[model samples]
Target: MTAYESLGAAVRFSNVSVHYPESATPALTDVNLEIDEGELVLVIGRTGSGKSTLLGTINGHVPHFTGGRLSGRVEVMGRDIATHRPRDLADVVGVVGQDPLAGFVTDTVEEELAYGMEQLALPPATMRKRVEETLDLLGIADLRAAPLRDLSGGQQQRVAIGSVLTTHPRLLVLDEPTSALDPTGAEEVLATLTRLVHDLGVTVVIAEHRLERVVQYADRLVEVADGRVRHGSPAEILADSAIAPPIIELGRYAGWSPLPVTIRDARRAAAPLRRELAGAFPTVAEVAPPPDAPASPAPGVTARGLRVDHGRVRAVADVDLAVAAGSVTALMGRNGAGKSSLLWALHGTGARTSGRVHLADGTDPASLKPPQRRSRVGLVPQSATDLLYLDSVGAECDQADQESGQPPGTCSALLADLAPGIPHQRHPRDLSEGQKLALVLAVQLTARPEVVLLDEPTRGLDYPAKDRLAATLRRLARDGHTVVVSTHDVEFVAIVADEVIVMAEGEIVAHGPSADVIASSPAFAPQVAKVLAPVRLLTVDQVRAALPRNAI
Candidate 1:
């Protein structure tokens, strides 16, 4: 029998504290926690709040892989992490990082899934059986022969999870596992994870920003804030926590005795609020153009007969759309539904088989050079770090200012505006996923481009950070800049998007205002919309505005 079988808990931490080099603050401080076997723990925190640091301690990556000072004891599967390296704990621990591509070891989906089993020297018959089972479990069987690089971001995330599952480890540690997936795809992965914990008795720990998607499935909630950790049941912790999902926020706003964490509970409790809001129509704040804009503004972007092909697959097909000059449009769809491809084609990057894309001035964006393209339209791709090559954040900001011909510290100022308090000297790779995205966003906005396109922009941001980003996009629209965001965050879309465009099978399936499209569709509806159905409320803020002063 293994050490974990003798011990009661799957993982234990006793007065754990981690300190990195050249950092005055400890990443984790005096953390005392224990995770029982077969428990599914959800970790929530703001951007750069050290959620990842706590997970790193599980598999000995804290001090073993990353050079740092680790104090106190961290035991995983009853083995002290201080003595065991990451590879030493491989049999009991399987980890998937925030960036899935970084962990991939092979070229194709099938090979990547079997790579871990091969490393463990499992028998050929067992490996083959496990590989097929994992592929089917994760809903990636059709992609067995597909190359890793060609798959969409969400597809890559599934393969990453499947790769570690084939090892049959006792503990699974995942960072933002559903960040890149669409709503349906996220459900499939989460359902599979829930099954693993219940049926196979796997211990799962996940750190995610989109709490609405994972909070309902959590057996316990762990909140990491400023190097401290707090743990309890999902309802118990979220009741008093500062960061909460839309569902919890709605429950609190409606004065429910106990805050609900799922749509069904909230819906059962929302009847009174819906009655109060009867006949009240939701009002969206209008964004007026800046004073410098022309009296009759041209369309921000216009496309016709756009198509993007990849080998035998048609990623985007004969799409036609127009975005207003001062508006925020959300491009939303399931994974591999052509959202990212359309954004790339619009920005004059990626492969475009045939299309006509024109800017406000009726200029073809694809005709411009790289530098010229930046001035007209800027793009922050799904992999935000791919845009950063410099060593330090300060150096990157300086370069962006120089290239954009903006004043020195221009990019730094934007960075502070988006995500404040990021260290200037820190390496881009060393920063959390959310921090890297902010840095890239600041760099791209330095040029003051006419049109901005961001793909999966909310992958690692917290609730407050998302609020700030929403305010920023609203400000951009008010200033006569065009903004387009392709994301799977339905709540975020409800907040920021003036227009919603749904794509499927490389075509525009639904096009209309945010409320009409999102509220009607069960798959894309936010928690508030789902809870207060028929009333058409999309966010907590909207619900607040519609209620009477005394009711609040």
Candidate 2:
């Protein structure tokens, strides 16, 4: 018999508290949570709020792998984590971390998927069958031979998930599994996971910031904040949650008791609100420059015949586009639609088979050196940690200040503004995913570049941090700094993007105002837009602004 087959609960935490070395506060404190067999539980919280720490304890990574002190009991499948290390529970518990690239052990997609099964001593035929099943399940069958390093961030995330799913563990712990996926891809993965829960009786626990996508599949919700956890049904926790998805926010704004967690629920509850807003048309005007600002601030970025080739694959193909000055532009598409390749080519870092990219001064970014290119166009890639190598957050900020020729602590101030409460002495790699992204963003902005590019910037950020980032991007536009963001977050686009550019198969398929484009497209539409259809309203803030003071 298997080691944990006799256990009643899939996971159990008994008054668990964790303290990391040299840290003033515990990562998790007085936390008591339990997950039963065949349950799909979602863990929700802000960035750096101990959601990851709680997930780590499931497989004994907390005090064992993380070198922290544990005061209470953590058991996975009734196996005591104090005695069972991560490897000891590997057969029954599988984990996919926030950064998929970091966890990869093989070079190719097929190899990675088979590696875990090999470790379990599964027969070759079984491994082959499971590998093919997982690849097709995650829709990465065509990328089976593709190198893990060359695949898009979303593709890597799928491969990572597939790698774990191939193991067929009784319990699965996923951290931001769908954070890198497009809307459709996310839907596919979540549907597959829900099937696993219903059909196979697998227990799944997920921690995600994009709750709009996964909340519908949750059997229960666990809220983690300040090292504390609150567990209940989705409606029970989100009814009064300060950090909520746009759909939940809309439900709460309409004062719907038992707030909706799904699009259908919100839409059903929004009929009256839709009637109230029937006559109102929401429009997002470009942020106007200050009166004292220069009349012709600067020319925005323009590219003609841009093409990026990766081996035999043509990632970006002859894309021609122009970004207007003092405007926030959002580039969006499916997993391998060349958004990252296009952004890198624009930033003068990625390969360009043939293209002409010109900045404000009619200068080609590709023609400039590294430092000059950074000053002209700054980029925060999908792997935000690639830019961080310093020992501590303070050290990284100081280096950015020195390299960018900015005054000391300039980057530090920006970091504080972007994500507050990040300890200066903490190592860059040790910080949470959102915290790392914030630090890299601060470093890039220290150069005061004319144009900024961010790829999936909201992957790890909570709603509050996204609000801060949106405000920062809007401020950049108002200051005549062109900002371009490649993301799958439709809600964020509705809030920050003045113009939306949709790419498909490496070509721009649709380009228009955010409301015009997203409202018309079913796949890209935000939750509020989906709920309050026929009104052209894209955000809860827009709905609130259009209504009377007490109407909401």
Candidate 3:
């Protein structure tokens, strides 16, 4: 047995099966696994692959929340999950789910952070102390008085984590906690997790689709597919995993030994390979076609003097932005900056006061019906799952295509665009968070709208999902579809956005090319952008290209 096995099994499932009330098949089937104390393990799979179900099972949520029939034993900290209530497991196991907004029970950050502690009936003084400690631990002490809704997506998520941390549970489970955060916010959350695992000796289990960020940090890797654990590792498991991170995939394609796990490792592994294959190196300098001339109306989506009022607060006032038909526009802002509100306005769902908004190339700005909007703009809402309710992935795609009146085979075509040759019959929601995101994207693209608006597309996606989404957007822009994403993923914006718009207190503070805007606003920039600032490179590929052959 290992250190994990020796910790008396923080979680144990033996021949576990879960079947929903109306479902014919089991959501989870005959599964067995063990996670011990002080271990940091990563759980990964496409949506509906049982990742969330499995995580929920550890706390008795499987049968309780979904009216599911569960068979077999699920033991968490020596307690049977099925017999114990979710509230019972709260003391030993802390869960920070993907959606922060849904998890919050209190209006203010301080109260929200203290709620878990209060649930355990901790003394008021103790709860207060724990709340302050947790706030400091996550580095969000200043936002304690802030309303949960007033904070940015990233800030809200951090508070959620702080709430769970205040309980000091032995096992910390996070399901895509960093999904809604920008690069900087993501780093902050990850850093906090790292500290908890390293300094406090807490057992951490994180189910995420973004493998790159956590792969290097994870002590163990668990991969699930078809509602079963397919891969486990002490030795590296990247080569055998279908959803391996980009650097690992790149290494596998290049046939590097001991498959690299991190970008630095990939760099070192590729150094000699590049030199050895210099004479036969494939030309990678294929520049995209020159951008089309700025049209009479500027060939873009431009919002001038836009104003949006949020209750008594004027969230976004006098904002100006432009997104070209063949380019990406990134909306950058701190929490409560009205980024989502602006995206909603553009999607014809928000409060728009005085502004002249235009969709260049003859796109009608007045049409508000679903059909009318489908022809001019495709929207992947902030929560892509808000639109998904089908029984399976194939069904969801078909439904999207049918509703949008896109031709048959549209979903399969979009799948091919995301991951060539992947099966279409798989459950759409069963895919890993990243894969589910891809399906939502495919569904959106089926409309083939000239302009695409995504609100926080990268939220809750693992690194793999982020990279794939970024690549897909780049390709879409290259193909001349206007792409506008309102996001906190600064690295994503830095890599793909031709133009950047900064929204602060519901007003446009800055607008320019991505490079100039990112340079001027380092505080809101991506981690990589901040790290490589002054030198300036966006994507990882750019960083690789700019490096000297022998730099590694």
Candidate 4:
């Protein structure tokens, strides 16, 4: 029997258009779609492409909390969402938003898990049972008592899911849920969600960027573009639609039919091509980074036995870290693992930090004035727009140059080095996520501070943008500006960092060169390393070179 016949309609939208009160552009327009029970649909789109808005409509969040103008009809579980309040719809639909921090309500995992059931007025016994079941399903049972603030990013995200699932909703909608998770964490979450669909008959719908990871699991593929449902399908949808992964794009570019959906399928379809292309093997030439310029003999920044506290909680403790005259040190941990607090402590942002944080001339970071500290160190906040308050990209860079006392347009030129071909006159908000990230990187690099700290700089960028950012970072390191970045993207660390510091439970558990540390650790390891098991090959080129010449 068809899913529609078996479980009824979980979600249906016909000619749905959502327009915000103050916005000229509609968030979603003329969208028509239906999700049947026990069906898993993959919604693919770039950032700000209305995927979030469409997903939000399933539970009446679009017109309710957002106060958007809604046209057409939205029905979930055969109930009209327009007539129902979000709280009413919450009973049938569980949503995990892109920002996990936004969805959290309580302090501890146990409290958060119990929140939905409490809202629904469930009995204590029922709530307890549901919370435990959700925790076990998500594999976060060990963290039941942990504070929401103390959990890793992946763990925190899982907790967000657990909180939502406590309601026992028939429909689950996930928005970029695995964006910040490591491969293993992502795998675990996806596996759990998959089981929930197959075993419990929950309807699953997720919007994500890493399509290759979830495409294989989705029963239906939905493409959203220009604020409309451009296409849909089980077989022909993927075959005819434009929504697919990078490797699929590569295959399409090379004119491969029956495009591979997953890596295994890709491998099979590519075997013949590999045989034909073996003689013409593509060589990934090592782009020798510019020669290491001798750094001026000036102290950059140093942290000696540093410890940070959040009230009674210690986010970072007894961590000795350093950034020399010119280098990049990447700090990696799961979310809520003290990376952000450490970055703030290094800059002395009024956070409670102990031990010693020093700049040039052995000056204590905590003692330095704000202006003096800023001149010596630059911080690019997670949101580039947070640092940008200008009209145009060029103007923002110019402002950074003036504030830093550098030559006019110096920051703009730095941006050119980081991301060429970007128009300076364009509004910073109009740029792609990667270009925006590049703009911030350029602004920070222009200050030419002795030390620079980037927090999840590549959070929203695509693969190409990531590659460009990685290249620019290497150039920055080689040029002698000590760099520190905290991120969840292990693939990025594998490519750029000279040193990788792994933190867990507010303490530095592992620290060493990237290759060695990533090779040894399971939590912070890169995707390439996992694929080439036993060996610690971090980059694709490394794997390519390591493969025996005759392996193909």
Give one digit per residue, the lDDT tens place, for model 3 in 1-552: 643345677888899988876556677888888886777888877655678888888777778875778899988888887778888888888998887888899899999988888889999999988887888777788888888887767788888888898999989989987777665667677888888889887889998766656777788888777677754662366767756655664465556688766556655665654443333323322211113322332465777788888667787788777677777778877766888878767766567877766777544464557787876787787656667787787787788789778788887677666654345666555455456666788888887777888888876554554667777787777777888888876656755677788877887888877766775465654433433333444444554454434553
Give candidate 2's error at residue 217 in angstroms. Answer: 0.5
Off by over 4 Å in 4: 1-7, 21-24, 139-152, 231-300, 309-317, 324-326, 335-337, 350-354, 380-448, 460-475, 494-499, 504-552
The predictions' CA RMSDs to the true structure, in order, are 2.5, 2.5, 5.5, 5.6
Worst 10 residues of 2 by lDDT: 284-293
Write down the lDDT that model 1 would get.
0.90
Give a tens-digit lDDT track for model 2, residues 1-552.
544566668888889999988788999999988799999999999898899999999988888878989998887887899999999999999999999999999999999999999999999999999999998998888999999999889999999999999999999999999999999999999999999999999999999999989998999999998899998999999987768999888877788987888788888888988877764433322111112222443459999999889888888989998898888889999999999999999998789999899997899998999988878899998999999988999999999999999999999999999999999999998999999999999999999999999999998999999999999998898889989999999989988988899999899999877877888898999988888877777887777777864864
Model 1 clash count equals: 0
lDDT of 2: 0.89
Evaluated with lDDT, which candidate comes out highest?
A: 1
211-317, model 4: which lDDT tens digit per residue?
Answer: 75677788888777768786555345656554555446545544557766665665656555444333343431122111343245354687888888887778888
Looking at model 4, report the run of 10 residues with the lowest lDDT sum: 282-291
TM-score for predicted model 2 compared with the true structure:
0.96
What are the models' TM-scores?
Answer: 0.97, 0.96, 0.77, 0.77
CA lDDT, every prediction? 0.90, 0.89, 0.72, 0.73
Ordered list by lDDT, greatest first: 1, 2, 4, 3
Model 1 TM-score?
Answer: 0.97
Ranking by TM-score: 1, 2, 3, 4
Which residue pairs in model 2 clash with each other? none
Question: Which 10-residue window in model 3 sums to the lowest lDDT?
Answer: 284-293
